[model samples]
Target: MNFQKNKDEVFQAVANATEEAHRPQNSVKIIAVTKYVDSSIAKDLLKTGIEHIGENRVDKFLEKYEALADLKLTWHLIGSLQRRKVKDIINYLDYFHALDSVKLAAEIQKRANKPIKCFLQVNVSKEESKHGFMVEDIHQAIETIKNYDKIELVGLMTMAPFGADADQLKDIFSKTHALQKELQQLGIANMPFTELSMGMSGDFKEAIANGSTFVRIGTAFFK
Candidate 1:
């Protein structure tokens, strides 16, 4: 695969989308989701000037993190993290995008040596199979999270339903952006809630238009 070509194309697309949305330059950052690739390929992608790397599973994240230890890259755990396995990868993460529960936040607070930047995952689409806080429960979750000194709530994340059409994608992302704005208005010290992680490769354009700050793309780069 032409890694440089893919990287350039993705950046250009995101820039165009950002401009079309009338958002600030560089407001959106892409996470090169490397869950399906190994460290060698991830390292190759990094050479093309992509600094953000994401992995979905703990074991795979550890393997790549160790293999690419010599390199300087921002690591993002963009998948559901089990509480029991928190100690293994909590300290290594730069950003945890799947903070779906306060119990998991408590676990991170227990294990982390430094504060971890986390995105409160919300089930915007309310899909039964998806994992995240329901719309109404986030208030209580944040109240509980305020006590966790080691967790910094930086943003909110949500996954739109698979095969969703443009209107559906827009609706989901719009609601997520609205929720993020609402949380930001709270002025909570630990919860800045400034970022929104709302898109994948397929529907990222709509996400950008709706104010997504981070979009996770995996298959697009690998292809």
Candidate 2:
């Protein structure tokens, strides 16, 4: 695959979406999700100027992390992390996107040597298969999360159900964005809540229109 051509096309889409949303240029960052590809492809992707890399599985994340140790990259763990595995990779991440529960936050607090930037995962679509705090439950979760000194709530992350229609995508992403604003207004010390990790390869345009700050793209880059 021609990485540069793919990169240009994806970035142009990002630019178009950002412009349509009336958001400032460069306000959104793309995270190249490398969960399916090997470390070698990830390295080639980075040469296209993608500084952020994401992986869904702990084993794969560690494999890529070790392989890419020679390069400067911002690692993001974008999947639900098992508590028992926290000690293995908590310290290695620059951002943890699936901070779904207070229990997970506590585990990170116990295992991480320093503060870890985290995005509170919210199941805005309310899909039974998705892992995240319910929209109603986030306030309580934040109350409990405030005490985890090792965790910094930088933003909110969400996954709209696959195959959702445009209207469905709009509703889900709009709700997620609204909720993020609500949390930002709380002015909590540990939660700056300035970012929104919404959108994947398919629905990123709708996500960007609704104020997504980090769009995680995987298959688009690989294609």
Candidate 3:
């Protein structure tokens, strides 16, 4: 299928990007950003040995997820999850990215029927437009996580400010890694903060260097 071919090229690119970054110990898992991209393509990509496909909206993800239950795919809620929509997002999706606040995290924990995996979105760049918890609020979020039962805080994820100068990209990704270390050391029971999900189509190489375990690529893979 054409999607397999696309997935191969994307995987090869991931390997090449991983090698190019020269962080052999650090592996980067790619979540084919399938928002607005149909389920047929998602299935094709899955057939090509992909397990993760990210969806940016709660409603659309639920609709598509229900339609494709036969396929073994991990749906990622990769958009800003509103508190009101938490109940909706918890139904079908398990792995998630944009948990912007402790309140949202708590709502996810309450609504989740199973032990869902989540990444704390960090605003490393401290940009006003980005959807994430501030660095200072990390511990508070962790504390909030202790109150919830149905979800596990797996790691952290972030997107740098758009048009970030190459020179400033490292600073952003590195801050994410540094925060990951700090959070990991806190020893949040079963919630082991391991994955650092930062990087997009452009600065993925730099994101790898700073220790990104997952990279959400849309244009890079789909184009």
- Candidate 1 residue 146 C-alpha distance from true site, Å: 0.5
What does candidate 3's lDDT look like per residue over 123-213, in tens digits? Answer: 8888887888889887766776776777778899989888888778988888889989888887877578988888877888788878898
User: lDDT per residue, candidate 2, 26-67, as tens digits?
Assistant: 999999999888999889987888889999999999999999
Residue-level lDDT of model 1, residues 1-223, one tens digit each, is 9999999999999999999999998999999999988889999988899888999999999999999998889999999999999999999999999999888999999999999999999998899999999999999999999988899999899999999999999899999999999999999998999999988999999999999999999988988
Better of 2 and 3 by lDDT: 2
Clashing pairs in 3: none
- Report, for every candidate in turn, its global Cα lDDT versus the true structure: 0.94, 0.94, 0.80
Candidate 3, residue 23: Cα displacement in angstroms equals 3.1
Off by more than 4 A, model 3: none
Question: Each candidate's TM vs. the true structure?
Answer: 0.98, 0.98, 0.91
Collision pairs in model 2: none
lDDT of 2: 0.94
- Model 1: how large is the Cα RMSD against the reference? 0.7
Question: Candidate 2 at residue 175, lDDT?
Answer: 94
